[model samples]
Target: MTKLNLLLVIALLGSALVLVRTSYEGRRLFAALDRAKNEQRQLDIDYKRLDAERQAQATHLRVEQVAREKLQMRTATPAVTQYVGDRPHAASGVAR
Candidate 1:
């Protein structure tokens, strides 16, 4: 009967240790998941902010402003326009 009691105590201690280890693992996994979710939320917010900035930058007025200011571009006018008369190509005898 004493040997049986010792065996039972050993089994009970092993079970308690397994339970504790699994509970600790569960808490660790839950904390990792929470951190991942917070990171995802922050990334989503940053993406939205960058998307808004991109939209603002891609507006027609912004494009025109950049073109004129940075590229020194201007609207075409007849005074500055040049036209070339088509001549027959020597290789294909074509005017296109």
Candidate 2:
């Protein structure tokens, strides 16, 4: 009877240990999941911000402003344009 009591006590202690370890692992898993969710949320916000910035940069007015101010570029005037040919020339005999 004493040996049976001892065996019962050992089994109960082992079960308690298993329960504690399981609870610890559960809390750790929940913490990791929460951290991942927070990171995902932050990434989503960053992605939206970057997307908005890209849209602003891709606007025609913004592009033109950057080109004029940063690149010092200008549009060609009609007077500066040289038209080479108004009439079609006869094709030379160089066809395959």
* Model 2 accuracy (lDDT, Cα): 0.96
RMSD to native for every prediction? 3.8, 3.1
Model 2 bad stretches (over 4 Å): 82-96
The digit string of per-residue lDDT tens for model 1 on 1-96 reads 999999999999999999999999999999999999999999999999999999999999999999999999998999999999999957966667
Model 2 per-residue lDDT tens digits across residues 1-96: 999999999999999999999999999999999999999999999999999999988999999999999999888899778888678867999886
- Of the candidates shown, which would achieve the greatest lDDT relative to the real structure? 1
TM per candidate comes to 0.85, 0.78
Candidate 1 total steric clashes: 0
Candidate 1 vs. true structure, TM-score: 0.85
**Candidate 2: residue 47 lDDT (0-100):** 100
Best by TM-score: 1
